[model samples]
Target: MIKNLLFDFGDVFINLDKKAPEQALAKMGIRTIDEEMTTWHNTYEKGLITSDQLIENYLKKFPQLTALSFQQAWNSIILDFPQERLDWIIELAKSKKYRLLLLSNTNDLHIEQVIKNMGAVRYSQFQNCFERFYLSQQINLRKPDLEIYDFVLRKDDLLANETLFIDDTILNTAAASSMGIHTWHLEPGFEDVTQLFEVKKALF
Candidate 1:
């Protein structure tokens, strides 16, 4: 039986534009994100660069875009966070059926936009649902890395066999699965996270 539920916040609960970077760059008149820019992005996620620095750096690299234009492009990655998901998770948490946790590979810039788009009250409600919520930026670690899984497991004294991690990314799922934790890769056409627990029982 699954005693704990670990969820990825992006597509599992909220929707995101998968081509956001491409689209954002197009809007900013940048043709593409080059190899060096990719490293800068990773550095930003790892807390090596501040959001302001990232904004300036990106804009400077292009030099053809306005700061506001880049800012808009940056925030375009953020998408709708539906209330239905929140309500569902809230009810699920209240049942005490499992220890709920949130583990997401997200950075400060995206979070800032989520806060702005979701508002403080709604965002707080979402954060409060978790027994523990871990963000990659704050932890200085991202997914597809084994240490993060170990971080949560050790922190909560979780048994891998009894922990279920649901994420939209295949790499993230693979990492957790390698550690013996049950995982579900959320796919829009084939699976729905809202019905996960029930589906697991049905599989039995």
Candidate 2:
């Protein structure tokens, strides 16, 4: 039986414009993110680098864009959380049937933007629903990485087969599944997290 539930924050709980960063950068005349940029971004998500380092790196490559402008472009991917999803999770927490955990690959700039978008009151309510909240930037670990999944499992003393991991990204879910965790790879737009009971009836 699934006694523990691990959820991805982006798309699964809150809405995210996956392509917003590229679009935001494009508007600034940078059409593409090269391999080096991709490495930098991943490093930032892993908390291996600081925000100032990222800004300095970007400034070196694109002298035209200021630190503030780059930060705005970087944080463009975050969007609002729907109230219905919040209600569902809050209800689920009230039941106290399963251990709830939130895991996300997020950075400082984006997290700040999330607080601003979600409002302090609502964000606190959403956070209180979870037993543990792990953000990549804060944890120094990221999804799609077996080590990170192992850390969560070990830290929580959770059995892999008894845990269900839900994420919008196929890569993340696949990694979790390989570790013997049950998973739901939620499809954006077509599938909503609020319909968890209806969608994964067998699990319940």
Candidate 3:
């Protein structure tokens, strides 16, 4: 039986315009996100680089872009956290039906934006619903990496078979599944987390 619920923050709980950042950057003359840019982003997500270092790297690459502008463009991907989804998770937590955990591949800047968008009270409520909240930058690990999944399972002493991992990204769910963890690759518009029990009824 599924005894633990592992959820991804973005797209699963909160909505994200995945292409917003790229479009925002394009307006600032950063028409292309090159290999180096992607590497910096990945490194930032893993906490290998500080937020200041990330901003500096971008500023160095595009001399015309200011730190404020770059940060604005980078944070454009974050969107609203719907009230109904928050209500559902809060209710689920109250039931204590499963061990709740949140694992997200997120960086400092994005988190700041999330707080700004979600508001402090709502964010705190959402956070309190989880037993353990793991952010990629804070944990020094990221999704799609086997080590990260192993770390979570080992740290929590959770059985892969009993933990149901929910994420909007196929790549992340696929990685977790490879390690024998149950997963739901929830499609954004077609699937809502509130219907977890109905969608994965057999597991429940």
Best by TM-score: 3
Best by the lDDT measure: 3
Taking all chains together, each candidate's TM-score versus the true structure is 0.93, 0.98, 0.99
Query: Model 1 TM-score?
Result: 0.93
Location of the lowest summed lDDT over 10 successive residues in candidate 2? 195-204
Which residue segments of model 2 deviate by more than 4 Å?
Answer: none
Sort the predicted structures by lDDT, highest score first.
3, 2, 1
Q: What is the lDDT of residue 33 in candidate 1?
A: 77
Per-residue lDDT over 19-68 for candidate 2, one digit per residue giving the tens place of the 0 to 100 score: 98899899999998999999998999999999999999999999989999
lDDT of 3 at 26: 86
Please give the CA lDDT of all the candidate structures: 0.85, 0.94, 0.96
Candidate 3 wrong stretches, greater than 4 Å: none
Off by over 4 Å in 1: 202-204
Query: Considering lDDT, which of the candidate structures 2 and 3 is the better prediction for this target?
Result: 3
Residue lDDT tens for model 3, 21-62: 899888888899999999999999999999999999999999
Between prediction 1 and prediction 2, the one with superior lDDT is 2
In candidate 2, which residue pairs clash?
none
Looking at candidate 3, the ten consecutive residues that score lowest on lDDT are 24-33
